[model samples]
Target: MRLSAYFMPTLKENPAEAQIVSHRLMLRSGMIRQQAAGIYAWLPLGYRVLRKIEQIVREEQDAAGAQEILMPTVQPAELWQRSGRYDDYGKEMLRFKDRHEREMLFGPTAEEMVTDICREIRSYRDLPKILYNIQWKFRDEVRPRFGVMRGREFLMKDAYSFDLDKDGARRSYEAMFRAYMRTYARLGMTAIPVKADTGPIGGDMSHEFHILAETGESAIFFDQELEEKSRAGELTVDSMNQYYAAAEEKHDADKCPVPAERLRTMRGIEVGHIFYFGTKYSEPMGAVVQGPNGETIAAEMGSYGIGVSRLVGAIIEASHDERGIIWPEAVAPFKLGLINLKSGDAACDSACEDIYRTLSEQGVEVLYDDRNERAGVKFADMDLIGLPWQLVIGPKGLAAGVVELKNRKSGEKQEVSLEAALARLTA
Candidate 1:
């Protein structure tokens, strides 16, 4: 995308309301704008990143054998009532009434709705079905803070599994748990599975995927070894769950074998969660399947969720540098940044255009900075947006048949032939 035509509304100063670095950078970088207390308008740049994250989540879910199906944001209150959670869900649930004097609500989660769908398609033949969606959800937070980290209205990717029995539910839950690990790992995040409170979901097993960050909510005590290795890549449902990882509430000091010296304690942000709620929703809503002997049984079910939009903010919190976000290649909006350092210089402009064209032809996502701006301003904006690789062209470099190659993470610089730079970037 050309920066000249792009609608990135970057700000020079930080907003007072933004409390954390990610929040501030998101505002200053023109990624998001607050429309209300915790609701945001994802601007062009931010929307691109959000879509990229959502796509990665979708790919992983599909790979794990889950079917994609979008659910409604607004649901009938009758579904929540059948699940016995209308009043139990408390103020966080955004309850409302339609103009016809009928009860309605913006769904905070989709357990009830999904269960109802399963009941409508009842049969043992369709014993195990996995359905998922990427949609918006609303929770009326009493004190909305920290930008998208704890927003009132946010985008989320939630998947639900309906199975014939407890054993089938366990398998479905494990599949999602494994997929979650891969999803975060692709984003260059080390997410530890911590036991979490199931609350109104009412489940025997629940786990929260927490990304360790200095500015996290719950304190974490975990195995020191997990920090060294990449858990996200080398994980699956078959792996033993005997690891010592838990949130503060579930942490048992005596049972944990990590010596005090090797133990690592830090705060973390919960990015994903999975829970196995045996017959909670199915039984309540009559989501039943028949056995071979003709006996009807409530479907065992599980729900898995990844905060899709929140990940854009969480990723910044985990991997940002002094300038701005250092996006992982898998989730970066663009792979290469082409800067016409001397936009007015005919030679430099021609070289940048050629390189940009070559990269584009090679199927590379390049953000060409063609605006008439100072070299410093161009470089700063390039780093601030954190494209993986930046190719800088100037009159001096173009005259010598070379352009500068910059690695955003290490701040490494090299002057190479235009052909070599193209090879390196497109490689």
Candidate 2:
């Protein structure tokens, strides 16, 4: 993509309303715009990043044996009523009436709806399965701030699992637990899975995956070794639970297992959650299957959720520097920023064009700056957008048959021949 034709409306100054680094950087980089309090219209650049994260989540979910099926954003309120949660759920539920005067509500979660679907299946053969969706969800937050991090309407990857018994449900939960660890790692982050209360979702078994960041909202106490082990894919639900990791509400220092010296306190932003709510919705909603003995039994269920849109902001919070966001290559909107130092110069433009075409042909996503703008403006914008690599092409560099390549994260630069740069990047 060429910056000359792009629609990134970057701002030179931070928006006063942005209170967090992710929020401020998102606005300054022109990734999103506020459409309402606690709501946003994801701009092109931001939308691409969101899609990238969503795709990664989708891939990981599929890898864990979960099938993807999109659910409706506007679910019938009657489903909640049948599940006995209609009146209990508070103002956060966006309840309303349609033109026909029928009761309706935007779904905050899909437990009831998914249960209704599972009710259609009959035998134990269909017992253990997982279904998920990536869709927009709305919650009427009383105070929606921090841009997409706490937005009222955001994209989410929510999955529901069904099993014949509690043991199968446990296995399903563990599968998702491991998948979440893998998903976070692929997105260039290491997340700590901590035991948690089910809250209004009403489950005795639950875990929250929190990404540690200085600006995170939840205060956490955890053993340092679990984080390192998480990266090596050596964590299971049982093994992880044996370690000491909990959010402030659940952390009991007196009962802590690790010695005070080994216990580390840090702030973390929650990015994913998994729950094993045995028969919570199935029993109420009649989501049952026939047992081998021909007896009707409620299927055990679990729900897993990943904050697809919030991850964009959370990643920025964890990875950005003073200049701007330093995007992880796996999730960056574009892999490389091709800056033509002298946009109108024949040699500079030709070199950038050649490199851009080569990278494009190699299945690389490159954003080429072909605009007639000052070099400083281009540089600032590129840094603000936070492409992983920047390819600098100038008349001087072109004359020497080399392009200056810079790694955004390391701030390291090297002048290499055009072919060498291409080889390194493609490799």
Candidate 3:
């Protein structure tokens, strides 16, 4: 991709409406545009990050034995009625009517719809199954704020699992819990899973995965060991949930005596949540399977959800620097930004072209700066976009058969032979 032809409309100053750091940075970097009070049109750069996060979530869910499926964003009110939640869901549920004046609603969540689907396939052989979808959900937020972090309409990756009995349901929940830990670890984050209330879902067991950030809405308290695991890899389910962690609502002062120094108190964003609800929806919707004794029983059920679009804002809140977003390599829009320090200068242009071709041949995603902008502007844009590597090809460095490689995270720069830089990057 070439910057000259790209549609990155960066701003010179922060938007006054953006109150939080993540919200401000997202606007300044031209990642998204506001369409309405709590809605946004994701720009190209923002869409890329959203898709990356969704793909990671899908991969982890698949690895945990969940099957993927697509459900409608708009559902009949009868589905909710069957679950006995049509009126209890509160104002957040956006209800409407179709052309025929039939009561319908934009789905805030898919519990009822999924339950209806499972009831159709009920049988002993189909006793257990996991179904998932990555789609947009609509919620009439009373007051949406903080950019995509709290939007009226956003993308969500939700999954539902069915099992023959209570024990099987617990096992399924554990598998998803493990998968969430792995997903967060791969994104260079620590999602502290804390016990939580089931709320309207009516479940005996529920957990919320919160990513600690200074600008988050929910205050969080966790043990000191969690900080060490923040950077450590190989996080198993036991290791991830070994220490005490909870949101402010769940904090118990008497039982958990985390020393002042050992306790990490910070605002945290809720990125993912898992709940094991035994027969909550199945019983109401008649999602029963026949047993060996020829008797029917409601299937135990669980649901897991990841706020796919909100993660983009949450990640920026947790990981970005003063300059702009510092995307994890696994989710960065482009791996490298090739900056031609003297764009249009024959020598610098030639060197940049050669390097861009080499990287492209290696199947690397590189953004080539072919625009005739000043060197300082180009440098700033590269930092704002937050590519992992910045290959600087100035005429002065090219004359010496060397180019400068700068690390986005460490801010370290080194002058090396062109061949050596390529080897280091490709390796």
Best by TM-score: 2
| Ranked by lDDT, top first | 2, 3, 1
Which residues of candidate 2, in runs, are more than 4 Å off?
A: none
TM-score between candidate 1 and the true structure: 0.96
Model 1 C-alpha lDDT per residue in residues 107-214, reported as the tens digit of each score: 999999989987875678887888998999999999999999999999999999988888888889988988988888888888877777887788989888888887
lDDT of 3 by residue, 1-427 (tens): 8888888899878899999988888888889999998899988888888888989999999999999999999999999998999999999999999999999999999999998888886577776788999999999999999999999999999999899998888888888888888888888777777778888888988888888787788888898787566546444445655777888887887878688789888888999988999998999899898887889989999999999999999999988788988888888888899998888798888788888899889988888989888989999988887888998999889888889999998899999999999998888
Candidate 1 wrong stretches, greater than 4 Å: 228-232, 236-240, 252-255
* Best of the candidates, lDDT: 2
Pairs of residues clashing in candidate 3: none
Query: Candidate 1: deviation at residue 377, Å?
Result: 1.2
Global lDDT for candidate 1? 0.86
lDDT tens digits, residue span 100-176, model 2: 98899999989998889878889998879999989899999999999999989989999999999989999999899
Overall local distance difference test of candidate 3:
0.87
Instruction: Quote model 3's TM-score.
Output: 0.96
